[model samples]
Target: MTNDLLGRHRAVLPDWLALYYEEPLELTHGEGRHVWDAQGNRYLDFFGGILTTMTAHALPEVTKAVSEQAGRIIHSSTLYLNRPMVELAERIAQLSGIPDARVFFTTSGTEANDTALLLATAYRRSNTILAMRNSYHGRSFSAVGITGNSGWSPTSLSPLQTLYVHGGVRTRGPFASLSDEAYIAACVEDLRDLLGHTRAPAALIAEPVQGVGGFTAPPDGLYAAFREVLHERGILWIADEVQTGWGRTGEHFWGWQAHGRNGPPDIMTFAKGIGNGMSIGGVVARSEIMNCLDSNSISTFGGTQITMAAGLANLNYLLEHDLQGNARRVGGLLIERLRAVAAQVPAVREVRGRGLMIGIEITKPGTDEADPRTAAAVLEAAREGGLLIGKGGGHNTSSLRVAPPLSLNVAEAEEGAAILENALRSVR
Candidate 1:
């Protein structure tokens, strides 16, 4: 049955939409941290649908909200006032650190980022953008242009002239050998040099932690340093928090807070998890930047009533349950356990990330070269052991990504860690 469905999926879907494992399982239902396949096999879900299920699978609160809202209305275009949309927007605006903030919703992170690009270019009157070296933004033309990862980006032709910047990844680059402070200095100097040779850029967009780049991140204050330089030159700082927002990082509610000594970013784009599986994406910026567009704009399905209902319920549950605190405590133990396991496995090149977002970089034994083959083996092994995980990296796709729901408990973390350890061992 799974094979038949896979055949149909491949026949109609874009070839670029990749699936995991040698044979993919058809997940039919989920509860808490566990999901059941069509064939009756159960597995612990660690990647949380690419980290979109922020709270839990089949969360009662979100489920109830969706059902209740659907009974009333699924959508009532932007032409009419939407109570749920306004309420969700208000909640997000208050939560967002940007002052005098305004919110505009989209259907996906890609659209959220695309909206951000429109605002930045209009506000700053420049088409040049600074993006991180190993970052993945979205699949849209503008987002793809700013995306520096070769694996995800397909075309060189773009609407915007993007300038790739350094400092997103702390390892595997010319400045990898430098100390934390020195690395920041070197990256900032590089940015300054790049600025001198280019047209005035509208903004520098970056992920607090490079999600598709193996969850890699630079020193805590690196962005603060970059903010200083960009602020002096009037270049806006845009934080792509699609994967790093809403306290997923444990220590910080927003990933940018780690380097927020200067203050919040000028604009922020978010999706994937805010609605807890519902299609909800948005951009938050100070009124000046958000309102820069001269013509009126609206997303036909951006802030639909049903999705807003889901977003409100999910956000409330996440905060009321203090999932961020849970993420810190449990994710701490999980990382330590994986680090211990990785120490015994030579193919495990490095273990990195914070909170529930972690990455295990696989490499050839006795060398620093990326080993995507070993990574694929570990992924398959983990699935065989009844655990669902994810894989990502730069062009090589050689890192194991582990981003479970923020509500994940200690027992689940330990169980997933054990399965992952055995998987890594099997591959080794």
Candidate 2:
């Protein structure tokens, strides 16, 4: 009955529910990099559903696969075997570069993370999992538990059982700096202290480039150290690639690789855009961990007929189109444009990130204003100008997150960057 009412009021949000409002524009349809509003106005989708729609809307390849797969078999109960499921898992393992990695599918990024937590606990039996402060893992119970934010405290802290290393995502502090090797050492020490003092060590979970936590990407060796530490304690490492996986990053398909980790995680999870907005989530565990799970088990959802086909289509499209190379090429253009913008914009402090994931830190005049208000203004200004971008960070300062389709071309990059430049000039 509740769902029926929601279905009836498709575009309406209840007043009692907290909502985020920018200006006003209704989405009509989309092609590659453009979206049409209700009134037929077009907007450049730089944000791309907060970095979820990697292949853009309605690609021929993805749609065709979905159509064919749907006709044959949309879904089967977990009790049944399906080719799409096996193929998806097999591709993820081969693509992930982890020897003999295996996958378990879920419905969302958070669900994948939750499954990673379970797999970690079952294999390592460690009591604690470590994540970065202000990191956005997911909103679900266990996913939110590992998330290093006060928002979920008093709610999940008592039962969730997770530890946070360092108080900031952008910098290793109670220490200091980005682009520093010492910060990595400090974080490792912090993890050691937390583990030694707590005696609860199961897994270390992190986003290679923290999307919501100020868009910070720590040193390349950060994961390697964590992997080493966890292994020493008979614990496992988990990489939550919910946002950074696939070809979005450009140079590599997954964020863990960008950091130059020596080995693979015991469990790695994926969701967003694995099927180009289709309802698919997955966890790729090392063979040892995966083998321990009961073979008869399954990753099931009640209504899941369509997701399988959509996921296969999305994966095929990514492979055929060479979106990974596109990410690198256009991502390079974006970085150069951002650096140019920083040279001009006084409020802009630093522009950091790799591949398609980028962030601009807005600092206070004297103290380097990371003003959230300013960030919000930029976001709204961009929206009003028909460029869709989003913000991530713990502070009030705006930490801009730019993740577009992996297939975005150089022309789109120029248009998006130019629009952003004009918006910056308009902002106070």
Candidate 3:
């Protein structure tokens, strides 16, 4: 049975397709923030499955919800609404503060972004969207195009302007300590200049806080300027909060909230943390904007009964514990400790981000920017040291994105920090 399972896909999964697995572990089961491989080795999961497992791995409430929902109905087309779907959508709407919202659910963040892109297009009836460069939306065609990162997709396939990037490069001041006003001014100017083009834009897409282009939390004032400008030009502002939502960004339930009311977006996309690994993504839009969608068509399994049940359980967990507050507290401790770790190792360029979604920027010996090799090495060393982490930060260099569960404690963060520090020191 094991041989058969391994052989089934060997024909297509070639050695070159081993990017994510350059140092892969055969992790079998996970509980809370810890995972164990088939070999019985334990590792602290600092990456939290790329920020998806919000509550923790196989959390009791979430598992119970899935178990019960599975015994019941798992699929019901959107042609007819189910209780779970209705309740889950309502709960997210209320939590998100986007009332009168008509939810469209998908199975992944990419799909959600695809839906949001289509939604923006339908509402504005325009052919172009202004995308920030070095931004990452998703892996699907449309999502990839709007991702804002060069080399990730064909330049031609990209939205109207990939060159519209601003504040993407860490124009630094640790996001927590930065002057929010100054950061916003700089980003807003670049956005205005981008929109100054003769071509009309249907929408302007952004990550309230970028996840893939390193975990960057730009100034708070950016979104409002973009929103106001986009609205004045009759363009929608799409907030891709897949990584920042679900209490990962501290007191703010979503990245938009991190920006405050001043930067509230018109439409927001969420997925990673919503279902806690249930593979569900959602879109929330103002009722007026949704009016333009000819969305009578159905998705056979989008927000299925089981998916919604799981979503509700995740929602309950978030509210019951106020995980957002926990993220802020734990994230602060992580930043402080991580900075100290960097201070000990000169190769660490900087520590960036807010909440649990953070990154450690590394530099080569005497060279600036992160070192992709060092990044990969540190990732391997960390894993070897019993921790799980991820790498991104599109420069020639590499940075580790540390997105632990909101439920993570100061002690766990300290342990993860120790592992990371050891990993950084290992390169020598």
TM per prediction:
0.99, 0.91, 0.92
lDDT of 2 by residue, 1-428 (tens): 43454445556875544323343454668898888876677889887777778788877877887787678777776677766677776777898777888777788888888877777777776657777777778777777778775543325643457778762354535666544577778878888888888866677788887877767876677778777877788777778888888867778878888655566666788888787877777788878887775655665572255776677778887888888888888898898998898788887777887778888777664465468777777777787787888777766536888888888888889999988887776774
> lDDT of model 1 at residue 115?
92
Candidate 2: RMSD over Cα atoms? 3.4
In TM-score terms, candidate 1 sits at 0.99
Q: Write the per-residue lDDT of candidate 3 for residues 107-210, one digit (tens) a residue.
A: 88888888888888877777687776668888777777776656455445644333455665545423323466766676777678877864777787888777
The predicted structure with the larger TM-score, 2 or 3, is 3
Instruction: Please provide, for model 1 over 1-428, each residue's C-alpha lDDT reduced to its tens digit, 9 standing for 90 to 100.
Output: 99999999999999888888889788999999989999999999999999999889999999999999999999978889999999999998888889999999999999999999999999999999999998999999988888999999999999999999899889889999999999999999999999999999999999999998899999999999999999999999999999999999999889999999999999999999999999999999999999889998777999999999999999999999999998899999999999999999999989999999999999999998999999999999999999999999994999999999999999999999999999999977
List candidate 1 segments past 4 Å from native.
Answer: none
lDDT: the better of candidates 1 and 2: 1
TM-score, model 3 to reference: 0.92
Error of 1 at 138 (Å): 0.6
Clashes of each: 0, 13, 1
* lDDT, ranked from best to worst: 1, 3, 2
Best by TM-score: 1
Go through the candidates in order and give each one's C-alpha lDDT.
Answer: 0.94, 0.75, 0.78
